[model samples]
Target: MIAALYWSMNIPGQVAMREGLEAQVKIINEQAQQTNARGIKLIPRIAGDGAEGIEKQIQQMYEMVALRPDAIVIQPTDNAALAKPLRAANRAKIPVIAYDQYIDDGELAAYISSDNFQAGVMGGEYVAAHFDNQKPIRLILVEYPHVSSTVERVNGFLDALSGNQQKYQILKTYEAVEPISGQRAGERILADFPQKDSVDVVFTVNDGGGLNVVEALAKAGRNEIFVATIDGDPKSVENIRKNRLTRIDSAQFCGPLGAEAIKAAYNVLRDQPTPRYALIPTFPITRETLSLYPGWAGPIPQDFKKPWSSLEPMWRGQSRVVIP
Candidate 1:
């Protein structure tokens, strides 16, 4: 069997996930060779950056469909933009597995990603714990509105904070999909707010932006604001350990996500039933728990338990909506 693994950008997180996928593919191939069974041929490609990158990803999807790979695993650059090509792959009878980002409209064999909503909830809970309901919190939110995962994270965070709505007020929201965009947005926020007293907390959807926000705060000599975010990048973890501006990070099990994506694609190719959606769980890593964190490129702490782990048996036979 053949598979095409399409990645969005060459960011740190994506790179780590790709490494995990590659490792799993190697193991699978080795086992197949030893057993004299068919092995999956994996073709990997990465998009450029920004708008141009998204276009390239769309083009690559169309090309992958033309190649007629047995299956295609994609981490979409833009959630909606790649729908047409994804549907084309479906029409071609090729199973498409979406990783990290969900395709809003498409016939996907499986959609694998971390429980983004829960990740946001973890961040929100961490922030909420820092202040009592009586204390007012001025919050600045930085988010990437393009991807469904980030959207879920934002919604989850807000949902967690809903109980304390009266205690916290969202001052503004900035759109930042990556580090550079995040830096720009952070600089703007700093320029506008200027004073440390203006903002009490900052919540970023991912560390890519969260780190930049911290930098912006530092540049303006305002590190007093507590920051919480998702994606426990190694730097973010270290920052949290050192008592830096970023206080908490909800870490995604990226390695497991990548391996699961490959496994789900293989199952579909083998004519086996695969879950429409498989959500990996995330854990919060704070300064106190920093030593235990396995870092961004993780082996995932064996002792760490996920709420959905016990429900997998039930999920296996659940009915799924097949996109036409």
Candidate 2:
């Protein structure tokens, strides 16, 4: 059997995404070596991200389908763009395992991803804790609209804040999941909110350009603006420890997430039972809880008493969403 692994836009900004893809590829090779049989052969594809990314990703998907690999595992870039080709793959009777994000339309043998929404909620919870709820918070959001995981994380973060009845006004919204845009966003934040306390909080959807934004704030001596971000890049964690503008960061279990996809695909090929969807949990690394987390290459630490995780059943009733 042969399978193709497709990672949507594996670019420099997304450290965890690249790491996850690498981990997935590594697991596949290891499995093949262990069996020493005619095991599944792998082909890897990455959409060179830029203005032409969607087009490139679409073309890559169609090409993968044409190869007629035994199965395909893809991390979808755009929710709706991949539908047609995915349906084509379905018609060709190829099983697909989607990781990180799901397509708007497709039949997948299995889908696995981090509990992105929960990660966002953790960020929101952190913000909620800092404020007394008497005053409105001025929030700056850094986002990436193309990917489902980023969208879900933003939604989850907002939901947690609103659900907690915390008052906040969105001061500005910027788009950056990579360095250039991220750096531009940082410069813009400084320019727009030159006055201290002009921006109370900055919530970055991921660590891609997020660390850059944090650095920009720190360099400009803008320590008053509280920062919260997702993706447990080691740099982000170190910043938190050093008492930078960033107060909290949610870390994705990237390695485990990728490994799960391969494991699911392996099961699908054998005609075994596979869950329709899997939500691997994400860990929030804050100063108070940083010791518990071991970074991305992790034995994702157990929960400590936090506002969100402390609720009955943990992670507010989604605790069962852990690595299988």
- Give the per-residue Cα lDDT of candidate 2 at 295: 66
Question: Number of clashes in every candidate structure?
Answer: 0, 1
Q: Which stretches of candidate 1 lie over 4 Å from their true place?
A: 1-5, 164-166, 302-324
Clashing pairs in 1: none
Q: Candidate 2's residue-wise lDDT over 173-229, tens digit each?
A: 999876667889999999998988789999998777798899898999999988999
Position 93, candidate 2: lDDT: 89
Judge candidate 2 at residue 204 and give its lDDT: 91
lDDT by residue (209-296, candidate 1, tens digit) is 6788778787777878898888877878877887788888888877777887898888887777777887877767886567667765
Error of 2 at 292 (Å): 0.7
- For each candidate in turn, the TM-score is 0.90, 0.90
Runs with alpha carbons beyond 4 Å of true place in candidate 2:
1-38, 307-324
Write down the lDDT of every candidate, Cα atoms only: 0.78, 0.78
User: Roughly what TM-score does model 2 have, to 2 decimal places?
Assistant: 0.90
Query: What lDDT does candidate 1 reach at residue 55?
Result: 92
